[model samples]
Target: MAVSHLPRTSGRLAIIAGAGALPHHVAEAARRQGEDPFIIALSREADADWSGFDHATLAIGDFAAISKAFAAEGIDRVVLSGAVRRRPDWRDIRPTLKTLAKVPSVLRTLVSGGDDAVLRMAMDLIEASGARVIGAHEVVPGLLADIGPIGEHTSTDDDLRDIEAGIAAANALGTLDVGQGAVAIGGRVVALEGAEGTDAMLARVAELKADGRVSSRRRGVLVKLCKPQQDERADLPSIGPSTVAGAEAAGLAGIAVEAGRALVLERPAVIETANRSGLFVLGIERNARERPR
Candidate 1:
């Protein structure tokens, strides 16, 4: 699929890529739009496909090195994307002499902190160096999921119940800073995504289906939304073609995301795959009235 063109940014763009294709998508959008983004692909998580871009491969522990790379490239703006599963251990971090000044505080945060807090600290570290940190959506707005059903299939009444249940369950889980996805089958919460992420949660659901733990009669629904307390810029929930396949494998009736907040990558492919697999993909608004106390 062709990358969508977006309005060009004034300063040079630096992509801090982690795992998955989200980085590739951002780079494609930047390149196609003539922004010419320089990517700082993390060695621990970023993929090899990024070889096509003007990029430098670095380790997650080397915060100082990342800043230097960006500075060298004259990058004044940055976008963070993909999954960094875990922060680098203190032992693994190698701060340059120039970066050593901030190491004590940064390491302290990494050693004992919330994921969101750590990411915010990381952003602050970067921004302190004069580079602007931006969300991936800013670089490619088309990646944000639109509201309502995305494919030919609409939600059945039963599916709606599951979606609501899943939303409530996911939000409850999110409050703990646990995760952003939950699976509800037949109006009951079958599974809540944990540290492992959405795909892992779906894999567990598939096991439940095979073991008769979850009813496969009406199929379930996968609901992924932003955590109310989440730093929206760092960890917004995202769904793509792989998500469709995972939900289908778990015998889900459909997949739902919080419109505007969640990202829908490979949009056409996601809708087509969902339709082909007999699953519906919808973006919903978590009713303000229904929010968990």
Candidate 2:
């Protein structure tokens, strides 16, 4: 749903903030819509300054505290935002009665399953506590990427080939619930993002190029796409100014993400960075058949 047309509710909105600027962005958007959102900043995981809003800092594993805060603040709607750097220690979790029964299964998933599975379980727990979970995009739809080039530069035919290779690799990786990003160069898959994430994957590519393992003559493309079984409300693939800098340092020709499914953080800054670095940022439509769960 579009941000402007979001249905109004009497109940307050609570932002379960983690690391990065995304949570701040969502909070600002909510305020613009005339809602005073209560920020539930996860201790250590959240990095933004939340002093401007009505907020409480709490441990990520303290579910009992979070549930109590939600009730006290009258927060019936919740939006999960930002990157979580670490999984909570099983010993630290203090589940409420509603979540106590499923604690064992949730802990098992946290230890063994991939990110998608862990997130799904987290969302289920949040709902079980009586608060409705919503995606960050629902609060800030303008952040979604549009189709075609987002900067002055555009992809070349050779770059398109690399992009195609990246898409295939990224999608396959997503099917395993491993990650959502891949790098392709000279029309061949070069690196698939693992738990280390997109930036680290690009850094690896740069290192390989420096060692002359991968050819530096031909640049590549970085493609990020949603997992076939991804829940759109959280952890959508995203790129920003730092991504442009990483691609430039990695000697990449461009970056591509699924048009409607990816988030383009700090669009203006990303565009300016890409243009100055002579890199292209394109949003391509994903092929349904190519995404096998």
If scored against the real structure, what TM-score would every candidate get? 0.91, 0.93
Expressed as tens digits, the lDDT of each residue in 87-196 for candidate 1 is 77778776665555654477777788667767777777777677888777877858877777888887887788888899899888778777899999989998888778
Q: Which pairs clash (backbone N, Cα, C closer than 3 Å) in model 1?
A: none
Error (Å) of candidate 1 at residue 107 is: 3.2
Output the number of the lDDT-best candidate. Answer: 2
Question: What are the candidates' C-alpha RMSDs?
Answer: 3.8, 3.0
C-alpha lDDT of residue 188 in model 1:
93
Worst 10 residues of 1 by lDDT: 1-10
Per-residue C-alpha lDDT of model 2 across residues 1-293, encoded as one tens digit per residue: 23444688889999999988889988998898888999999998999999899999999888889989988999888999989878776787777878867555887876787888778877887887888998777777578887788989988878878888888888898999988999999998889898787889999999999999999998999999999899988999999899999999999998998887899998899999999999999988776323211
Candidate 1: give its CA RMSD in angstroms.
Answer: 3.8
